[model samples]
Target: MKQSLTLSWLLAVAFFAHSQSFNNLPVNTQKPPLHGRHWMAITGKPLAATAGAMIFTKGGNAVDASCAMLAATCTMWDVLSWGGETQALIYNPKTKKVIAINALGVAPTGATPEFFKGKGMKYPPEYGPLAAVTPGTPGGLMVMLAEFGTMSLKEVLAPAMQMAEGYPIEAQTANSIERGKEQIKQWKYSTKVFLPHLGEKREAPNAGEIFVQKDLLETLKKLVEAEQEALKKGKNRKEAIYAAYDRFYKGDIAKEFARGCQEQGGLITEQDLANWKVKIEEPLMTTYKGIEVYKLQQWTQGPAMLQTLNILENFDLKSMGYNSTRYIHTLYQAMNLAFADRDFYYGDPAFPPDEPIKGLLSKEYAKERAKLINPDRNDPNAKPGDPYPFEGKTNPYLTLLEKWGTAHLHKPTSQNPLDENFLEEFAAGTTSVEAADKEGWVVSITPSGGWVPACIAGNTGIGMSQRMQSFVLDEKENPFNVVAPGKRPRVTLTPSMALKDGKPFLSFAKQAGDEQDQLLIQFFLNMVEFNMTVQEACEAPSFKTYQMYSSFGKHEKAVGSLTLNSEMPAWIRKELSRMGYKITYQDRTSGPINAIYFDWENGSFWGGSSNHGEDYGIGW
Candidate 1:
């Protein structure tokens, strides 16, 4: 108990110092993330960080540590679980290559935006069984291990499986449970699985309560058994790993999942599970200030960060003063422009190209788009710039809908602010993790889904995602984000890496729904442009704009509006307001922005986890 108090006191002191800064120079009162000569693992939760470190002690690399940490995160139902979505960018120094893993569940082959619209629903429903997609977390993790990890499934899963049976619920996890308690009560399995405390007078477990998820334990045990069986059959390590993946997607677990979905009015069948496969795409790469930045494609909102950087690269940011009114204004306009293009053009690879997205990431195209930003005014309704000249003629979806009259084929717009309530329903709270070994192997992952309104697979205790709600109900107007069978939604769960001169320099992710990349971009700039340490860069004030349609349901937006952290100087806020920015106030706390930095010159590592909630960065 005394030890806990000391840690809390230290963190409180750190956060307070971080909140105040002068002239863009840190006051040095804050506690920066730890630097190490060996391996490091930073996670959304401390237990998961410990699990990853456990793997490192076992001589496992970052790929192995990441897998262990991811599984450990699944032990509790806060932001991630076995039924969640997992997307990652893995860096292999040996090959000098980075790979993208799109391991998210799809609309259950029967899902179409029209189907929901036909049901008299303008926006897709948020809660209940009908909202679920086929879960891919288990399969994704197994697959990642099979390809890059040297640890066995039995080894990596040990920590997660044990914790699934019982663990002291952390404060944030408990709060998340309370947030979804009402939804949990609507489903018997979810109630029994996640909110067992409901059997008592409480709605959910309180922090430090001994919460146990027996079904998850059993499910993980089944996966381990499957891998062991493969070994008994003389299978190699990789093949044993494949056996574990198959067990989750095509074996008994799949059967249980299909049955659960069917009972809940979902359309996924045994076939969908067997047929589902995660695509490994080439990582999206671009050069920023001579350094290479990498991300997932438009399937996520990842490229928007790169696009924002490309636009900002045109100006001398150092002269603007970090977090100054000039800097904030320019950043917001750049983000608004990038997001406008994202709404118009980014979408599933399965869809026919209206125009090459490559052109959207081009420097010349960003120059053209940057011209649209006005110094004296903020555009209430920013429209996508034409990258057609760079890629060719404009595609059909480019001009699909302008004025929403007949083009107003989808949900009617309410005068209400583009409330994130729509995003609240679809996106499960998410978590990001970064792990690295001494050998330079790096892994960054964002695990999502299985939160409130999660569908537990009957008695299996495994949760399933509702990511399908991210799809647009209007088929015609939203050319890129329209719901379709076998198509992944344009999810906001993007994890990223930035390379300095073609070498790994930084890796990071945020969990603020569509605002993920917008927040992280500032962190990137504070480090790259201003040379702030990891913690100082992250703790700096943030500014955001809601001027574009959200990637989530109903596609709501607040055109021309921007929100600045209230902690920013009042003078700067007034200056921004005078510049015609629709201004609002928000908290400036960091966390939900976990990151790690590689200092090649010193041959060391620095890990930083946002002080928000229960996250921690530990290294050796």
Candidate 2:
């Protein structure tokens, strides 16, 4: 009897341990049958993507759904908000053409370099009331929906407004909100929305916890009503969309925004808002491996994507092996080279002509510069090289190159070292949405607003952006990023797409500051050349180099390292170091990158989200 009892007790203990181990096992919630058609969507937050997909299922076109998703994301993901500027890349299968929308907001008219000097400030304020520019989200979304969409603003905005009025905060949303609480507390309006009743610290609102944004809901309703009224006047979708813009820019919303700016001594003016218009410009395009790549112009960091591709083309990437140390070194070299040029020349083309970074992305210029990359040696602190100019006298590209090369080579500079082991924090709280309709029209837009101050009061619920912090006040007493009368601030919000064989091949983008272009280039290479599936391409580890000073500073210059997810192979790191590429093993700091690729032969649409983000992609 004693032996029997002892055996039974041992068995019971063993069973309990087994059960506990099983409970602790990670769950694979990924559903199977993972392929589909009929419009696909991907973004940073899973809930935001689902919301956009739902709109598509309701017979709304990509633009309509994207517009709704953008508004909803601003409320849900405070880290990336609508109050900031936006840049988009769209493809029209009907026209077989790609177009870019520069919805970036301009500096206020009175904004000048002297403004910062007068304030005794050297850096452009990135957040608070000072950093705010004429917001372009309303205008950009309206333009897309008007020109390419089939649904009305009322229909598209209904779901988002409902979401704003009362949607549960997810774990991702809670994390971001908490992270940004300090900045949010500065603005009364932002504080009200994020921290309704603050006391001792407590658990943040979790996933599925209801969050109601009464003010934003009301704002959406007002726009919807105005749009409906315009439609009643026999205005078509385009006109009605403009009507919405007018309601925001010239109507009551504009008045409120202007009033807020004035009260806070901000640069935004009513004229700035009314005069704001989205520019429909030709996309900057280049061919890589017979695949056509399209990116926005200099307004954002779009040109870097082109330059990286140009450098990669010079090497036989496939032969080098994917994600190998050789491949990563090459990629790092290409990025550093392009980034050097981007820091010197790229800016709002609308800015003064003398800005040093223009024409860096010209095809002739790219080809010439691509030859300078040396595959074997890692020029740790490599200086920019002069590529023979194709345009005019002085060959600004070569001139700037020569000047920078001499300064870089001879200057007593500290080789800024990066913490090879320091991990970058993943920006998991933003959102992205992409859609295409049967009409052969595709729209991709990403809305973000974290790290900036939030106005919880007034229920503005929108988060602030730190983009303005990148601008430098010139020695000539000019505010390089001043909120001037009609000038938009420099931004990193670049959206991209690709075309192959005259069809929509890829629509993808991310929301990180400099990593946007780096990630996009990788996606393009992964899809067009490596033949990786959409999911595989997006899930792959990525790297970025910020060796030069851009509108964003060179603070991370010494940190010439790649931030890779832990999943990346250790051998790859060893190889990269051997090739002179500094390796920074990060858990995941790259922002959420979402992509959709259309397989012309398969007649199927492939969509996938980054493994590092809280986003999802689904189709039906």
TM-score of each: 0.92, 0.85
* RMSD in Å for all candidates: 4.6, 8.6
Model 1 accuracy (lDDT, Cα):
0.76
| TM-score, predicted candidate 2 vs. hidden true structure | 0.85
Per-candidate local distance difference test: 0.76, 0.63
Instruction: Spell out the clash pairs found in candidate 1.
Output: 404-408, 591-610
Local lDDT at 156 for model 1: 93
Runs in model 2 deviating more than 4 A are 1-34, 203-207, 354-359, 362-364, 384-388, 395-430, 449-452, 456-465, 475-485, 550-556, 565-572, 588-591
Count of residue pairs whose backbone atoms collide, per candidate: 2, 36
Model 2 alpha-carbon miss at residue 459, Å? 6.5
lDDT of 1 by residue, 1-620 (tens): 54553354344333433442223443441346777789989888889999999999999999999999998887766576677788999999899899999898877766877688788876556555656677888888988899889989999998888788788988777877777788777777888876766666667888898888877788888889989999999999999988978888888888987887678677878888888898788988788878889999788888988888999888877666667667778888889888877766777876654436878998999998888888777766677777767876655554454542232212314453334564353233578889988898999998887765577877778777767767776645456777777777778888999888778899888776777888889888878766777866666556766666655555566655667765566666688878876666666535368888998899999887665556676799
**Least accurate 10 contiguous residues by lDDT in model 1:** 403-412
